[model samples]
Target: MLASPRPIPSQRLSRLWYLGRATGDLAAGLGFKGLIELAQSQAQDRPARIQISPEHARRFAERLSELRGAVMKLGQLMSMDGTDILTPEVAEVLAGLRERATPMPMSQLVEVLTREYGRDWDRRFKRFEFTPVAAASIGQVHRAETHDGHRLALKIQFPGVRASIDSDIANLGLIVRTLGLGPKGIDIRPFLDEARRQLHREADYEAEAKALERYRACLGDDPDLAVPQVHRDLTTPNILAMDLATGVPIDRLAGPEYRRAERDRAATLLMRLTLRELFEFGLVQTDPNFANYLYDRTSGRIVLLDFGAMVPIAPSLITCYRQLARAIIAGDRAGIQAAAIALGYVGAADPQDQVAAMLDLLELAAEPLRSPGVYDFGASDLFERVYRQGRALFHAGVFSAAPAPETMFLHRKFMGSFMLARRLRARVELAQLVPLCL
Candidate 1:
């Protein structure tokens, strides 16, 4: 069933109003004791580490979700990256941002279509579904068929999403800072800047259409992968039209109905695709949300979706990664440290012990790559070990220096793949795949 339509707060003032209301709700939900704790923290002049109740978190998430733009997008990013820092209750609530978003009302949807395709836009289609098949931060996608009998998915942008990106990001940053909701002493400005840049690119459907075509070309004749073809006639800056690819969500492969072999194969293909995007195609779809992938069981292919978050990889960056990969595979500590320094994973001026700790964490992460044969993701506690080590480093002030934005985005994709593999309990042949990428 489609979510009940909610009009997006498109103007800066309107979005700010919703944010203020959400903040108000949070404060009220805290109760007297919580307010006292906040006052105490302020008196001491230390960072407020108030634990949000589940209900308060849910209310906050609902408000952001309703905005359906950069605010929601940033919330989704935080949900994924803030697991270590955010309380479990808050993280769990924010995770809902990844699911289907509340779609725009039909009247508003029609208005956008009319603006892009004229008042007689209905003449262009034999049938257009009023309900969205998928709703996301920037847009909602509807299944439609043209008079010529071509089936297409139309991604209609939320009105004013492009114009409101800057304000939405600024408002979100202010709220996070004021509430002391982010990590203490960490400079999140760089990440917020990256989010703003990415949001702008994503809001441009024209660019995404071009990115879709380019990515499809890069994957030409790949029997295991499928990318939808762009439908140029119906595409516009606010509307992206493409062939309607069919499949079940990729995460379904983790179910018992799927054979162990199938699970392994699916995960292996994804890992190989990630490597190819970095080392060969030089274009990576940086958003690793599982919804972006689908499994076509009938054809035994992985169908790719959503090209808005695609990023170009510099050759130099690829070279650094290749060096890092080879060093990890060979268990060469000196080579690994050198590559790490070059990649900005660790700074030259960082304390020796901190640098060594970072290197150890990197080595632990490369365990799968160094495995002689298939590495069983399900059997490994690698993620937990890495998380604990990372938390330790964070407390020791080792993560003060943020990696380059490109590196941060690329790692998000890598970690997404890793988490998915672990979820499916897949045994990937990283031993073979790592060499091919190098």
Candidate 2:
């Protein structure tokens, strides 16, 4: 069902413009580099010059959180990948910003509802919770039961989010570049362009509905998981209605009460899903926010939410990934490097020194996947090794930042889930799922 077009309001537009400008100003000031310098200065107090990164990163994150929107979305991404780049405190700030969406007041919500249900939306729902059940970058989700007695989750897009996307990305790119996070001196124009395209697609709920149906068909058979079903009729570009799969967040792995064995099972299911999404189905919901996965312990199912960032991979891309996976399983070092070079990850122009760094990273990444006993997330040394090599590569201008915009968001999602699994001390057999892809 097509949603009636909802026009943008003047007031919302002005608010977005104001937010965008504030973010741009901050980007120009304490950008990524500024954050690093601030952190570095704090490091001087220590004998080993150990960075007090978490504290400084938190300060910067506080600013990004206040700005919200696409910038907040970016902060969430940074927070998820904290193992490599950010200290825990800095990551906390980013993580704090993750689910912290600015609420769309009842007035704005009504304007959105009026467009979708023909001004009689309040009448359609027996009751609508004014307080949002979940809040994300461009939307806030509410809980409601329809007059027909169906329980549904309602996701309403924040007012004027679509219009400000371009400005948001442009401003965000400026901040990240000034922070020197990407390939130094590389033209990141392509990545920014891809981000804008994806964000616009995310603003559309119709596409998400279609994608959700397809995923249901794909993973509906997984006894250990649940993908929320889309309510097509109730759905608008802005409003996404679905049956809510209630559960404790996977992040509860961090709590003391969760059993060790239970945590391992949760981690296994998550790993299996990623392998299935990338290799078997060639379709994936790429965003890796910890908020996206929920643990319904009673049912032993992982609830997957959000499909706007989904990507369908080409056969060759899947082939490249599988080849890389195969190389790891076989423990073929030369084969791994060949595949990395073919995948355009290890550049031909990179001297032997840089090539060694790439090899070290590849070897570290393949470790837990290849080990016979268990992959230890708690003891994982890969993050530090990669972080060190990543910094060196950036300084050497050896690596050109590559966003398989397809795999880009997927990586974030996978990494975050894995971190959660690690915190739980989950011992999962990597080969079990990888073999399915094979």
Candidate 3:
């Protein structure tokens, strides 16, 4: 069910005001809760630990969702970055941003259509649904049918999202710095810059349409994968029109209705596609949000959506990752170290202890690849182990040397695939898949 349509706070002042209010509300809520918990703890002679309750998280998420742009995108990114660096409570709060966003009011939606199609937008479509089929940080997607009887999905960019990208990021940066929301000692500027750049590209429907067409062509009639076709005539700078590809949400396959083999095959296809994106096609859709993928039960094909975050992979980077993978598989520490240096995971000037720690972390991450066969994602403790190691590294300031922005983006996709596999409890022959990529 959709939340009631509320006007998006687009202006800098408006957005800033909302942020300030949300922050105040959160602080007050936490303060009051902490006092109550502290009283109880003192009475019981136990130490008090203040935590962000579910109520507080819901309130924070509601404000961010209403804003629906960089603020919400930042929250989504934090959630995807996982719990290694964040308190579990904070992670839970940001996780809500990944769900549906509050849609623009019908009037606001019509205003955009009028501006784009010039008042007679209704003439072009046989039928247009006012309610969005999907909504996200940058835009909402509506279901519509063309006069020629072609069903289409129209992605409408929010008003002022493109114009406010820089200011939005700048303001969010200020808030993050003031609140110390970032990991201590680590410079998040590179990540912020990369996000700003990606948001700009995402806001441009024209660029997204081109990316969608190119990515679809790259897939080239693969039986197990599907990409929507762009409807060029219906596309605009802010509105993207494409063939409506339908399926159950990709995560739904984790349910009892899906057989173990079906889940395994689906996850395998995603893992293989990730490799192909880097090593073969030289293009990667960096957004790892599960919403971007869908599974057609009847066709048994994965439907890919949202090409806005698609990035071109440099051949050199591809070679570097290939080396990294082979090195991991071969259990060659020296090879892994070399590849890590090449990939900027660690610097030569860094302390030897930090470097060695990073290597340990990398080796742990590659455990699935080292497994003999059919590593069970559902039963694995890799994420927990990784979190513990990562937290240690973070406290030791190992992440202060941020990787190249491109590497960060690619890492997100890789982690996203891993998380999806875990969610489906799919067993994958990662050892076999590594060879094909190599």
Candidate 4:
């Protein structure tokens, strides 16, 4: 993820204060009995129990949402990036925090616009739609039309979002600790911190404008893809202005109108882009949220959006994964094991235990590359079987803790994209594409 801009010392302290306030509530409720019950419930066949009440969960979600700074950012990460760590109830509750952000008032909106486009900015736009077309945690987007006849999408960050970031992060750490998410279990802190950094980078419209141009140039001459043009003169640190591209969400391939071959081709293009992004480009869009992709049915191309979360992969790590892929295809289990260990995936104690897990995980990903015809992602029991095996490991103390935060994000992005392809019933020549990297 792109590095976040540094904050002032006062801002950092404020963030810690907010974190303390949130955790203070949890500490008061979490008595020794609560802790014991949490342990007993966790020891059972299911996941760790939430000894806390539904009412408290709602309250917790609300505070995080209202804070809507780093705290909400971390909560949203758990919703998407750490879904496995949470039970269904907790996941559902936490996911709401992603969408529960209170909107910034129109007055705040005008203030932001004035700062970006100047006092005469209203005159440049023939019409400004104050009502947002969509809302996410960090900001809301509005459809606007300029006198120059360009329909643009304006992304306006919520008031104080930048200012509150540090405090929110500090508060998030305190809450996670108070709730007992540490190295012994799944350490979600890295994921949370990384997400916050991206969100902060995203808050900078100027950076996104630059990243958008870089992506467009990077993917130049590709007929099957599209990236929107940025209006640099009008862009600002918080307000991103770009041409409003028209296309349906990529998942539209789920429709019956999509031919199997077309579905497969679409999936192929996406997977190929992913491979190139990592192996060749050394740059990746770390956030693979479904909303980022759009389908142009008439042209048979995919429209890519949101460059703020674009990240650079280290050449060494990319080489490591590329080697691992070559080993997997060559059926070198020992090589794969060694790669896994080098990647901090396996500890010396019961090392094979983790290798077995990696094998099972890779099998799910590699199945399509080995098999022909439209892959039936719907029919696969990978999720259930993996869940069962994972639960067993947790019980036996054979399974180690979570993968590195970076790996976890990469897995989510891959799984998310793979699921999209599977939804399309895409028949990609994944195996054929692997050798291209080597």
lDDT of each: 0.85, 0.70, 0.85, 0.68
Q: What tens-digit string does per-residue lDDT give for candidate 3 at 1-438?
A: 567888888789889988787777667667876768756754543434556666776687788888888888766765663444345677666665675788999899999999999989899989999989877888888999998899999999989888888888888889889977777877889888988998898899999999999998889999999999999998999999999989977877888988999999999999999988988899999988877888998989999999999999888999999999999999889999999999999998889889999999999998989999899998988887876688768766797677788788898899999988987889999899979878
lDDT of 1 at 58: 80
Considering only N, C-alpha and C atoms within 3 Å, which residue pairs clash in candidate 2?
32-179, 33-179, 286-409, 286-410, 288-413
Per-residue CA lDDT of model 1 for 1-438, tens digit only, reads: 446899888788899998898777677767787777777754553434556788887887788778888777766766663444456677667767776678998889989999999999999999999889888888998999998899999999999889999999889898889878776776888888988898888888899999999999999999999999999888999999999989877767988999999999999999999999999999999987777888999999999999999999999999989899999988899999999999888999889998999999999988899889889987887876776677667777787677787677898899988877876789999889979877
TM accuracy, model 3: 0.90
Residue 294, candidate 2: Cα error in Å is 1.2
For model 2 the TM-score comes to 0.85
Clashing pairs in 1: none
Best by TM-score: 3
Candidates, ranked, TM-score: 3, 1, 2, 4
Candidate 4 lDDT by residue in tens digits, 255-278: 788787777787888888888878
**TM-scores for the candidates:** 0.88, 0.85, 0.90, 0.76
In model 2, state the lDDT of residue 408.
59
lDDT (tens digit, per residue) of candidate 2 on 332-390? 77777777776777876668777777767777766667787677776676655555655
RMSD (CA, Å), each prediction: 4.1, 5.3, 4.2, 6.1
